[model samples]
Target: MCVVLAALLAFELFQPAHAQIPNAAQGYQRELTRVVQQEWGMNGRVAVHAAQIHQESAWRSNVNSPVGAQGLSQFMPSTSAWIAEIYPDLGRAAPYSPGWAMRAQARYNKWHWQQLASAADECQRWAFALSAYNGGLGWVNRDRRLATAAGDNPRVWFGSVEKYTHRAGWALRENRHYVRHILLTLTPRYERAGWQGGAPCNA
Candidate 1:
């Protein structure tokens, strides 16, 4: 009984840390995680940003947002071209190539997060990076400034932003659904990997 309890406790502790992120996520999410892990040396919960990508593009390689963001991770054409230019390894083909796009996203995500302290954990940086990825860091910054001016909580994710406050459009709805999907998908994987966060496989 003691041995069984110890085994259960060990599994519980190691579960989230060893949680297997999908190697391929039907389309964009898979390609994106490959890049993130390959280029960024990020895996496990540290690479949770893949969840954000899954939510955003649902693995579409050639999708363009109504706002004109393009490709798997939905980069703005200018952003895509600019990244390609800087990392010429990410050439014209890079934007269209899922593999290249993943590396590019990893590079971009790394660069963006490097602006913050290295001591920060993945959860701390991932959420901020997701905000930047989704809403544009400039937009997020502008919102923060406005919130600061208004004496609101400028640092947290409370619904202080005008769009969030107003429940703007399908972005919020779609994002929520996507995040939920990632969470649900992860729960099962976590269980299979011996995580206590999920129902028993035998049951």
Candidate 2:
């Protein structure tokens, strides 16, 4: 936690600033939790995923990113198109349907996890996998190899491997900050709910 806090306070690179959670999501919480738990596991990720959707798209069903990412998940066109192909029903109504968008986000988050295997516990898994969600899986793997080559623990995210992320071609401050922000802000909520990955988070 101290490491991430230092990174947040000392970062000199360009990462997009994010706003805090809205006071009222108007049922967004319950619905999002339901959708995420259904598609992902009943694990504590429901809150994390919901927080991500809040940060990513602010729960806007019709939101579009300047980079062509769209929907509640801020998924890129190519990614969403692929998501739609696999989740035909959910993708059919994406970007315009809040429910569908959340569903798609859940599925996509799962896909992100599958992109890499981890011997790390659930908490560390989120640190690595969420970085992949924001950066790219290939970049994360590349950084892992870089960390190993540099005599760092490839699986240690915050204090070790994350340092190598900035060296990867596509790894940027935004991706590093994304995982930190998510865990920092939402871990308590997940821990209170008895989620697997919520412990040891001082943030």
Candidate 3:
């Protein structure tokens, strides 16, 4: 019992200070916390979602991408419409509603992850998943095949698939940056939350 208590105390001592959710993002952070922790059981990786919120629109509910992605998670109008058709409550929520947009993001990520089930671990899994979230899954998969044909592990992301994406013409930098940024944002927060080995190269 004494050893257990000490272990727990050590864990608490090393945890990072709470994430500094921005003032304008008060409600957005709250809803994101709820979705990542409660609905998705991703409490250890809330920062990945937080990273997307930051990258996509800097937590702005009203922001719109030049490509037509709107809201905190930057869903395209057609994608938003499709999400709404599949999830009535989530889709019905205003595009500017942080909760709704993030909920959609979580929903999309859940489905997106299914397509990469062969990923070696959390690192590889999220790397490919985030890339797919930015670029199309079809393209990410095509690159994965290219990497494998060139003797890389299709299941490993960093040195394998991500390396090949640099030579990919369409959105090459964007796709690589998407995965890198998410890992950067995710690792710090998750480590603070007691998660282990979430780096881009971990798997």
Candidate 4:
């Protein structure tokens, strides 16, 4: 009995803390699925998007960050306005609306994905896109250019362009952590929880 109890304790201790789906995220699965499919088609990386949302707002529809980011997708006011303007179908900037936030997040991620054609692979492309989402596409572009100038592979993200940022140390750390946390950590977590899309990094 002692040995059996010890084995059970070990199993529980070894389990990932985030292995379970977040309670806040449970309510939005259907809406997220619909939005992701609409924006990215059937094979869209829903898990990746879900993980992004997890990082952004932990599925809190009413969250407002100290820096003025808002809602589930955590879009800053300026970004929300811009996205609404560019995609008029999204209507007014309603960052606090769960539906709007999910759709806007998908659209914004798609926009980043479209511009990163030089990425070495799907995984690298997503890393660039996520970095763009966290910081700015201009930063990623400059970093890639700098990496190229230094003989690093501009198409790669992890050890290449990610190492060439011109942003301050804090911003650089946040961006890199944001990309890796979403793609490498949270993506797999969402995928394992039975989310429809698979992890891009695992591809």
Q: Pick the candidate with the highest lDDT.
A: 4
Q: Write the per-residue lDDT of candidate 4 for residues 38-119, one digit (tens) a residue.
A: 9999999888999999999888899999999999999999999999999999999999999999999999999999999989
Clashing pairs in 2: none
Q: Estimate each model's TM-score.
A: 0.58, 0.78, 0.78, 0.91
- Cα displacement (angstroms), candidate 4, residue 20, comes to 5.3
Best by TM-score: 4
lDDT per residue (tens digit) for residues 159-197 in model 3: 678877545465898888777756654345544553332
lDDT assessment of candidate 1: 0.52
Candidate 1 regions with alpha-carbon error over 4 angstroms: 1-34, 42-47, 116-124, 158-203
Tell me the lDDT of model 3 at 104. Answer: 85
**Model 1 residue 57 distance off true place after TM-score fit, in angstroms:** 2.2
- Summarize candidate 1's per-residue lDDT along 1-203 as a digit string, tens digits: 12432454445454564354443454344444455566656533322445445555655667778888776667887887777777787667355566766677777776666653331343334444555566556755665577667776555432343333223567555543433333334434434543232321111
RMSD of 2: 5.5
Per-model CA lDDT versus the true structure: 0.52, 0.67, 0.70, 0.87
- Tell me which residue pairs clash in candidate 4: none
Consecutive 10-residue window with the lowest summed lDDT within model 4 = 1-10
